[model samples]
Target: MSQHTLLIEVGTEELPPKALKSLSQAFSQSIVNSLTAQGLDVGAVTSFAAPRRLAVSIAKVPSATPLNEVEMWGPPAHIAFDKDGEPTKAGIAFAQKNGVDINALSVANDGKIDKVFVQIKQGGDAVAALLAPIVEQALAELPIPKRMRWGAKRVEFVRPVHWLVMLHGDQIVDGQVMGLQSGRNSRGHRFHCNEAVPIATADNYAAALEAAYVLADYDARQQRIVSQVEACANQLGGIAQMAPSLLDEVTALVEWPVALAGKFESRFLAVPAEALISSMGEHQKYFHLTDTNGALLPYFITVANLESKDPAQVIDGNERVIRPRLSDAAFFFETDKKVSLESQRERLKNIVFQAKLGTIFDKTERVAKLAKSIAERVNGNAEKAERAGILCKSDLVTNMVGEFDTMQGIAGYYYALNDGEDNEVAQALNEQYLPRFAGDQLPQTQTGTLLALADRLDTLVGIFGIGQQPTGSKDPFALRRASLGVLRLLVEKQLPLDLRELLEAAIAQHAALPAADGLTDTVLQYMLDRFRAWYEDAQIAPEIFMAVSAKDLSQPLDIDNRVKAVQAFAQLPEADALAAANKRVANILAKLDQQPSQGVNTALLKDDAERALAEAITQQKSTIAPLFANSHYTEVLSSLAGMQSTVDTFFDQVMVMADDIAVRNNRLALLAELRALFLDVADISLLVRAKA
Candidate 1:
């Protein structure tokens, strides 16, 4: 068997830019996995993704597939032979079915049964012959949400398939893939070459395409874009603000990238930098430049697909195109200030928030009340928080926010400040929507935090109350994100507010929602589930989360502290022994047919070990109660560890179940109290790792 590099390329007409890289990776990995499963000794794989194509190159792939030995079992030997020790009908039929003579069959016996069997050895085929269908299969399994057909062809793909190339070193594999015949031909950059470029060998694929003005590798192209854009920005004594996603999208848009510097009117900078930057980066895919003081510059960088002979023309064309876009943004900003943000409150009444939850105005009224209530509990100014909540969604009606959807909360901040509202209230308009996605910043001001909490709570409770809970893989309202946002605010902000109290307060504001049992509990559980994932990402132990969550603490910050305290205590040498004792105590309490009395009887105390353990518990109980009250869980957990020796000695000396009914009940009561102490933080019984 000879080893060779295998190349498969599927050419299309401009694949979706955002999905190009991922789709290319999936296609490459799919082919490699399929070949590896077939016992092929394929080597390194390189994937190529450009605007017009997705390709993979595998090195040192064996020319011949490894043989497979298959075993076939037949009828019992007793049934295969006649009474005269001659061939029976069963023996002859089996030989014919296996395509062999009757005498070629053999018999084998196991401990209890005798049977006839045959071993078939299947040989491998050439790599070139095997890859056409493999390439075709990989294309069939691409992660395209929708596929298209071209020119009435029965075949379909992410885009119309134009060409297919399957090469084993210098040899072309012969077959059809996605309606295209196999060949060594691949077209170069759309404007650079416009003609078929022949690939002599699989190893020369990238070099051949590069000569024709294309970067075959996505990462290489992206790095080039970054380097060129930065160099261009530095030339103007400013730094470019190009987001990574923007760079990736730009790389996908061009094959022969040529970064050029262009300038728009400096007057456009009179608009907010965010609006100007949004117009440039989002709508035009241009990289914006910032001056020394971090102020927006008039110049922007654009990546052109071709290096124009008269580069000034390209730059002029880009500048001319951006003038109208900036003018529109300026118009929206200036016109929107004519109306106060407060004036839009009446407009919200006509906008439906949800069919079941009245209108936006009604929801805002509910959020305002909830925010004020929550503010009172957390030392926040109720009036400021309420005012912020009422005006939070008011920007949705403004002309500026309507045109630039990303500017909703931000526009409200500017509008509120213009309307001469309190500085805190103006800031809250923007802060209420902080931390829009994972790892985003949370609200910093007291007013902002309370309003954010109030807004999310109203939506979550109202949505879940109407039985529109998010099912698997479908959260249209982003309930999971809303839930996590609420948790993040509570835990990260160190707010001592009770989650249940907030949920119920928010629920009470919704008169349209039905009064039902478990409404608060359902929304609370849903929010708590988000923490499981959040903590998992932090690499906290699953058992630690289970132990803390089992305690059902209503305050997220308290639960957070307890879990940390428990984690710290588990690191102590005393943890395993105390955890085992707790497990034993739990088992004893679970087996009691009758509920034991809450307190141990002084007269019933019998063993010295039990007496010593009781005294130790009574002493530490005083110290930890105050610590627990202060939410100083770390100190409390450490204080409990001092009683470990007494606990271990009692479990070692006294059996929990005594023959006498009174003694057994009294002992059960003592164990129950011991378990309850630990249960204040977590069910430590769950902390013990089961023995093998």
Candidate 2:
């Protein structure tokens, strides 16, 4: 087979900047998958994405797929043929489907029985013939929610298609894609180079685009933008606050990025820095600068799509545009600060949290009570926690927050301080929404922790109470996030809070929940199940989680400690033997009509192995009971690991179902005692030790 480089490009109207990276990568991967599925061999695939294009350049692609001999297995010989070995309807059907004669069918044993098999030589299609349909399928499978039809073409796509480039080596691979004839000509940057840049070969795609003032590689373009922005910020004697999302969007927006520093009025700094940053970044798509002390600077950097002879005009225009945006933010902040945070509570009464759960104001009342209860239990300031909870959602109705939704908690923090509220209360107003996503920071203050847990608990209980719990992926209320947030707060904060107790407390606060049996257990289990994924992501084994889950523990901190302990214990030399011993004991105990009621009688220990095992269990029971109380599960399991040899000897030499009834029952009792020790931490029997 001969190999050649394959180049594919789809030129279109400006693509969405946020979705460009995903679209480009998907296009390249889909093309590679389609080719491989057709038995074509391909090498490294390079993806290119920009405002107006999505493309891929594949190296070492075969011109035509190799011929293949595929085996077609039909029904078993007994079913395909009659008793006299004559062809039946099944055999005739298989022959017709595979385009072979019924007499030519071969019978071979497929392990169990003979089956009719046919060897068909499948011919390969030319690469040129496969390109168009592969590209069409790839485009059709893009993650586009809504597609549009442009002009009178009757064709729908993410955007209007302008041109299609398809090349095999230096020759144009002729085909039609998106109602356009395939060509080697690719359009350049809209302003810098408006002419069509002809690509001579697949290898020259990136160079040709670069010559026409286009940075086709998404990663390279992003790096260029970052370097330019940082340089601009360096000259301004501050650091550029280039958020990842904003950086990617800016990279997708321009082909030739020119970073220029622009200034906003220093007076706007009086507004909350968060609101100012959100205004500039979200509204104008500009990157803000910050001083070394983490204070917002007056300067911002904006990336232009083209390189200009005089960059000062671009900077001046950006400054003019940002002044009004910053002013709007400053105005919203000033207006919101006039009305007290508490006064905003009245407006929330009209806003519904959930139609079945009542208004946002009603939720705050429930959360306020819950926060106070949690604070008392966690040794926090109850009054301050209650105050923070009551005002947590007040920012949702504020002018500043309404204008910038991302500043919901942050705006409340500023307003609470202005209202002369306690410092912790004000901080909790913002911290209530901390850890908004995974790996995000948790609440730092005790009151903040209380309010955060209370808020999530209220939403979870209320939503689940109405039977609107997250089903599959249709989590319109984000109940999964709330559940994970609750677990994270309790576990990562080391609060030692019982989730079942908190759910019960939360359920009591919901006055209007529909009567549903087991609501508390159902929600608690759902939240506990979320730990499986959390542990999986941390690289903990699935069986380790399963062992801990078998105990049906409700306290997250305790469960977390046990999981870590079990993970450590699984690595010990004695773990597999001990786990096996526990499993054997469990199987024996499960068969009994009733477990051994009496403790192991020392008089009935007839075997030396059984006596040694009984003594080991007796000594460890006293030592481990205190460890279990303190939740020192690692120490407990490690101490239990020491009894593995004695356990093995008893199981090896002793007959558990002895002829003497007293001896048999005593042995069962002894085994039960041993299993119970491990059960205090987790059901080690459920553990599957990893093989060396």
Candidate 3:
């Protein structure tokens, strides 16, 4: 078998940055799995992705597996032979099908009487023949989240599959996918090098594409974009304040990146720096420049798809296009600032937050009230919470926010401070939306924390009350995020809040609205489910969660403490045995609860085992009661662990189901008490056993 290098390249229109990462990873894995399933040995498989192309290279891949003999079992000896030990019709047919003579047949006493079987040695085919089907299968099965139908057929992909290059050493792997045939041909930069480039092997995959004006590697292309932007900024005596996310987006927008500095009218800088940056980054994919003092400079960097004949003309065209966008931003900024934030609050009365719920203004009022109530409970400053809630949604009506929706909360802080509002009020207005994503920063100030929790709790309660709970990936209201933010605030801020009560208050406030009847329970339950999911994700044991969750999770800090106690208890050496004992006790109680039980009788405890178990329980009750009262769950669980041996001994030596009904009833009651004691920490039976 000869060693060969394999190369496959899929060329298409530019792909979104977020899509490129997932697509490339899927393509790479699919190809590797296909090759392995085909009995080929692949070494050092790698993948490269650009905005317009995805490529895979495999080095030192085997052509095929060597020939090996395989055995085929035939019919039983009795069936193959006749009554006189002569050849029968079945024998003749079997021998003929296997290309052997009937005389070659014989019987051997292995286990049962064995008959003749055929063994054939087969060799592999050419590498190209084996790889073609695998490559085709991988492409057909590649996972693309969003696909489009093109041409006559409804077959969909991220984009139209224009060309495919498949090679094995110096030979082309012949195949077809989606209406296109595989070959050595791949197109370069859509306009820079429109002609096809031929690749003979994986060795030339990258270099060949580079010469054809394609940077196949995504990281290399990103580096080029960054370096060129910096060099351009340096020439203009300013530094580019590049937005990392915008750079990533532009990196995936072009195959060959060329950065050029463009100028906008100086007057546009007078428009708040945020508006200018947002207009440039969000709309135009341009990097804004700032001087040493962090003031906005009148310069921006635009990434061109291709190098132009005259760089000055390209810069001039970009400036003309950008100036109009900045001017519009400036106009909106000036127009929006004329109205005080307080006035904007009044205008928000007409903007609907949800059609069934009410207007944004109504939602803000409820949130303001809720924030004040929560602040009082947590002993935070009530005045600041109320002020923050009122101004939080004011920015939503700003012209700057209308132009850039992502800057809603951020721009509000700047505007609020500019208007001479209290510093805490301005900070809280912005921090109300803190930790918008998983692992993002939570609110830092006490006032901000209180308002943030209230705002999120209000959204969760109102949406869930209207029967609009999130299902699967359909959380349009981001109720899950709001719930998580509430959890983080409670735990991080150590706020002793009752989540159930907060949710109830929010529901009650909304209940006066037209469609909010009977929604309080459903919304509260939804919030609880979110809490359960959050704990589960944090790797908290399910049994601990069930134990703590059985109570109201309204106070997130208390729930966290309970979870910590259970976790510490679970790590003990006798934890599993104790949990089993608790489960056994619970089961006995469950059966006893089906009928009335008489109280425990000391006289019925005739055996020493029963007396010893009863005494141990009596001793543990006093020890556990004080610990549980103090919320020292770790100490309570430790006391319960001491009952394992005594409980086991009683079960081993005493029969709980005695012949006398009274004795049996007494034993069951004792077990019930023991189980009740364990319940103070966790419902240990809910813990899933480890799989082997």
TM-score of 1: 0.94
lDDT of 3: 0.79
Query: Any runs in candidate 3 off by more than 4 Å, and if so which?
Result: 64-156, 190-194, 224-244, 258-273, 288-324, 511-518, 541-544, 550-554, 593-632, 638-667, 688-692
Q: Which stretches of candidate 1 lie over 4 Å from their true place?
A: 68-118, 514-517, 601-608, 642-646, 689-692
Residue 316 in candidate 3, Cα distance off native in Å: 5.7
Q: Highest lDDT: which candidate?
A: 2
Residue 664 of candidate 3: its Cα lDDT? 84
Tens digits of per-residue lDDT for model 3 on 1-692? 78888888887777767667667878888888877765667889778898878888888877775566766567887788877988788888988887778887666555777765666555576667766566666666767656787788665777877888888787787876666788988887777898988885668888888898888887788899989999998998888887767877887788888898888889887877877888888888899888888888999999998878999999998888888888888788778777778888998998999987788998889888889888888788898898888888999989888888877887788778778889988988888988798788988888889889888888887776667778987999998888778888888877778777887777766755444665666766666666677777888756667766766555677777777887787788777777777767666667653643535678988889888888887898888888888778777877778777887888889888889988887888777766667766667655434200
Q: lDDT tens digits, residues 327-442, model 2?
A: 88988988888999899899999999888888999999999999999988888889998888888899999988888999989998999999999999999988998789999999
List the candidates' TM-scores in order.
Answer: 0.94, 0.96, 0.82
What is the overall TM-score of model 3 with all chains considered together? 0.82
- Screening candidate 2 with a backbone cut-off below 3 angstroms (N, C-alpha, C), the clashing residue pairs are none
Please rank every candidate by TM-score, starting with the best.
2, 1, 3
Output the worst ten-in-a-row residue range by lDDT, candidate 2.
Answer: 683-692
